[model samples]
Target: TEHEVQRWPLEPQGSTSFGLSRDGRFALLYSEEHHLVLWDLEQNKKLATLGELDADGNAVSHIRISDNGRFAVTAGQMNFAVWDLGWTQAQGLWSISDALIRDIDITSNGEQVLLGLSNGKAIYVNLVTGRRLEFLAHREKVNSVAISPNGRFALTGGNDYKAYLWDTESGQLLRTF
Candidate 1:
């Protein structure tokens, strides 16, 4: 049996965070200088640079690429932007005045977004239909969030030491742990 190893040289910048496409074909790199770059992992080349300073003029602290690699979401303290990866363009940028965004995730088709907030709420947005739903399932800051592939369900974990699964459309609490 043989083992294979491959390495790609990245620029000598301080990377703060990164996300990879589910198929392992793309990489989203965030540097200390607030620079975001997309790399073609298989081709070993840079694909596109993404986003400016967030609405607050602060560095984006969180990044997530959709499972199918067609969408991406980036967040700062109180704002987030959704990107259409196929077009290499920003679909929308939004900010929340009442709560800070802790995490975000997008659907495979680039239409739905799930955002967990410091106000102990999870917000679901449908980009195409302009529908927004809120799920208030936690009592503390929501620290993590994820959405089902079909965009029907959401799971959120909060600083209150609880995790909840909820219906995205109706904001009904399905299960708690």
Candidate 2:
């Protein structure tokens, strides 16, 4: 048998949440201190910070890593930030809508993002083109958003006791449950 492990400090682990890269080489750590730290598990240490601090230094409420481990999205107070994990280390920050972001998820190809908002809006953002499409998704705050495994659709649930299915490319409502 074989074993794999890394040293993640237990001290000050304030309200921590994490995302592991698909290849299992790295981990992204977010804490209540308003910081996101990337760790190189193979080498057993921190790699770099995922993104710059927000204006108000708000703690990250939600985050998702792409299927290839090449991209990540962090939900900010008034917007969301996408991080390019490629060597070039580029990033895109978008304030596509004014609704308060409640949660977010990146697609398998890392091309788009679906965000659930407190304003009852489900926003789809094109990461490469920076295009946005937002529509009223619920009567109250949306609790979650998920991309289908085949990448053809999205599912979003809210406080209104409903879950919606949306076309990934067109952002059109496909079903209600």
Candidate 3:
């Protein structure tokens, strides 16, 4: 079977980063001009442009969309922003004072986020409760992070040549690879 391919042009031209929802219904595009545009793939229409420039007037370099298409996360060097797609408003904007954010992933419900940091730590934030737990299993920069669909577990990998699975709430190490 051959699938038809369609080209959709985007505004503000040069996009440096892009992310799509797990269900393939939404897309997040970050352009070179620091514009974050959201699109509804199924409807073929623009949803919203999100995020704001930081103190230095620089936006994020990385972007991720939640599995349910309810949320999006954008990360720059030291700060990250979370947006509620349904409301088209920012849920939170936070900065990590000591460590740089290397990667991020949000839970399907959009209530939590797992952030990988340069200090080899993975931090989990409960958006609703405002509680944070840190997983300290890696010894080098944490390069990647993921949260399970149920938001019970987190998986993280780093430059230390290892990957770890952790209990998101308890911060207990489950397995290492």
lDDT of 3 by residue, 39-150 (tens): 9888889888774635565666778888788888888888888888889888777888869899999887778889999998899999889899988879999999999877
lDDT of each: 0.85, 0.74, 0.84
Deviation from native of the Cα of residue 9 in model 3, angstroms: 2.1
Candidate structures ordered by lDDT, highest first: 1, 3, 2
1-177 in candidate 2: lDDT tens per residue?
Answer: 776654456226564457777788877767765377777788777777655536566666677888778777777667677777665253766774567888888877667888888888888777668677875868999889987544568899999999999886776889999
Worst 10 residues of 2 by lDDT: 6-15
Regions more than 4 Å wrong, model 2: 1-7, 22-25, 32-34, 88-90, 149-151
What's the ranking of the predictions by TM-score, best on top? 1, 3, 2
lDDT of 2 at 143: 84
Write out the backbone clash pairs for model 2. Answer: none
Clash numbers, per candidate: 0, 0, 0
